[model samples]
Target: MIKDIDKSDVIGPKSIDSPFLGSIPVERLSGGVKTLILMNNDSEHIFNASACGDNCAKWILKIAEKKDLIIRLGYLMDFGKDEFDIEIVNIGKTVHNSLELAETVLDNHLI
Candidate 1:
């Protein structure tokens, strides 16, 4: 079961450098939640999940780079109303594979 995260816990805008991905911004959105937003042209794909353990950001960046679909995350906060929308395709399998690949690469040396 996925636990709900409070918005007040988010902390970041931290910049990380990568030879392949360039400069990417990562944020710890909550105790177990982390997110990264990727900009492709005018569209922004926001990736968020609770699995952002050690090395999760790097793997997430890789997933964002590999996907062909564009996903958008929208949150509405007005008069105490809270709602969100996430648009994407093959998210689960794709992200799982990407994270696994990233872990493997991290464990080994890249050439």
Candidate 2:
């Protein structure tokens, strides 16, 4: 139910449509800001998610090239604190670091 993904969880081996973000691990996407979550059926697990942008997603794509990308995360506030915001994070200095950074920000919300 939206929360289940964790900082330590592996998000992908990637798909032709969805891909992984290097060693940090993540699921890839296409357009507008989206909410991604990891969940289980027992109702005991949860992973916080964020509304992420295209550029941010591209940063996630970068991880494919570099696994050593360390990350720092930020948030795109939407209409104050009422509406959830888009999260921004650096996967490293390169590309896919976005995913890792995003993961870190989201992970901060849960496991």
Candidate 3:
């Protein structure tokens, strides 16, 4: 039996299978939208995800939960061919902080 999943679990059985691990292309579209492209080797059913962009993690998680989105905790290649390591929760908080700071600065200047 596996360490976490029970014997009757459907992860490795016929229901769910992962022949290719970490082989999906995640694209960060504008307006905090993201899409996961499945690999040919993948079963076309199972996938994964980590985040969308700087502050889109929370929304991503929410939408994913309802739509049964597949999350891939892997890497993403941007248009500029850059790579980054990030989390959705932290990014959301950071963006919120930045917006708050900007608002405060604008208010002070107007006063």
Candidate 4:
């Protein structure tokens, strides 16, 4: 996540080496990474996934593969072109890809 989202390297347990910002504490990471970390580690609450950008979608799906993840998105998040099984809790519909998800959201005014 540090490398992918921040373009930095994890130098230690609590430090990251960022080319733009130099060394910084883990707390100084982007909100998207922080949110992803919370979602990955915590299973007790639903996260507002809109805090994440499209770049974070793959990581979100990866986290879902490890556990049941429930998240709320204020807008449609492009989960790339790959096939994925994601249930729209609002309509109780399971969509397999971006097209299906778009259709479901449009048909139901979910977005």
Candidate 5:
């Protein structure tokens, strides 16, 4: 959690319905910006794209529910380096806040 952000700043794990059927649990990742964690297949992936607000999280989850779609999205996003099996995890919009970005990576763990 960031110092200035209170619990009210956080949303979901409730608000955004499960987009991948009953699989992925979406929640607000800690930061002043609107970031999210999408969990599925026993793994957690971060989501913070320019188009990816809380609602976009659900849309991404819905589109990439299948393995093939995940792979395609990863390639399109140029996530050519990471070894994660689920490539959809590599998709990102844009960082809304750099401080929150750091906190998300350093402090938050969706897993």
Candidate 6:
């Protein structure tokens, strides 16, 4: 996914190969990649989902399936039309699809 998004191949723990930039350190990766990495590895911290673009929504859902993930989104994130179970913590409701999510978000002013 990082490869697709960043156009960089992760070569090693601290190395990555960007087609245009040549070899670079991991620190040079985009904020979205860094945020996704943190969300994937550290289950103890609450991540600011606002740092991620809509592209990261699916990954966030994937991580949630593996472990409990609590994220705060400052904007509306399109989770696609496919059915998904997301508990809106603010409204105490579980939404199944983007439409439901949108309704819930507006009803609760979550975004």
lDDT of 3 by residue, 18-105 (tens): 2333222222122233233231223456444433343444444345444544445443312121322222332232212434434543
**What's the TM-score of each model vs. the native?**
0.19, 0.20, 0.25, 0.93, 0.22, 0.91
For TM-score, the strongest prediction is: 4
Give a tens-digit lDDT track for model 4, residues 1-111.
868998999989999898999999999888899899999998888888999999999999999999889998988888999999999999898999999999899899877
Model 5 clash pairs? 49-93, 49-94, 50-93, 50-94
Pitting candidate 4 against candidate 5, the one with the higher TM-score is: 4
TM-score order of candidates, best first?
4, 6, 3, 5, 2, 1
For candidate 5, the lDDT comes to 0.32
What are the per-residue Cα lDDT tens digits for candidate 6 across 1-111? 578668889899889999988899999887887898999998888888888888888888888899878888888898887899999898789889999888889887766
Q: RMSD to native for every prediction? A: 15.1, 15.8, 15.3, 1.1, 14.7, 1.3
Reference-based lDDT, residue 26, model 4: 91
TM-score winner, 3 or 5:
3
**What residue runs in model 5 are displaced by over 4 Å at the alpha carbon?**
1-48, 68-104, 107-111
Q: Model 1, stretches more than 4 Å misplaced? A: 1-48, 68-111
Instruction: Let me know the TM-score candidate 2 reaches against the reference structure.
Output: 0.20
For model 5, residues 28-102, the per-residue Cα lDDT tens digits are: 333322332232231345333442333333434444455323312211222223232232143342333434433
Measured by lDDT, the strongest candidate is 4
Q: What ranges in model 4 sit over 4 Å off? A: none
The order of the candidates by lDDT, greatest first, is 4, 6, 1, 3, 5, 2
Candidate closer to the true structure by TM-score (higher is better), 1 or 3: 3
Model 3 segments beyond 4 Å from truth?
A: 1-51, 75-111
Listed per model in order, the count of residue pairs whose N, CA or C atoms clash below 3 Å is: 0, 14, 4, 0, 4, 0
Across 22-58, the per-residue lDDT of candidate 1 in tens digits comes to: 4545442332333423322324444433333433334
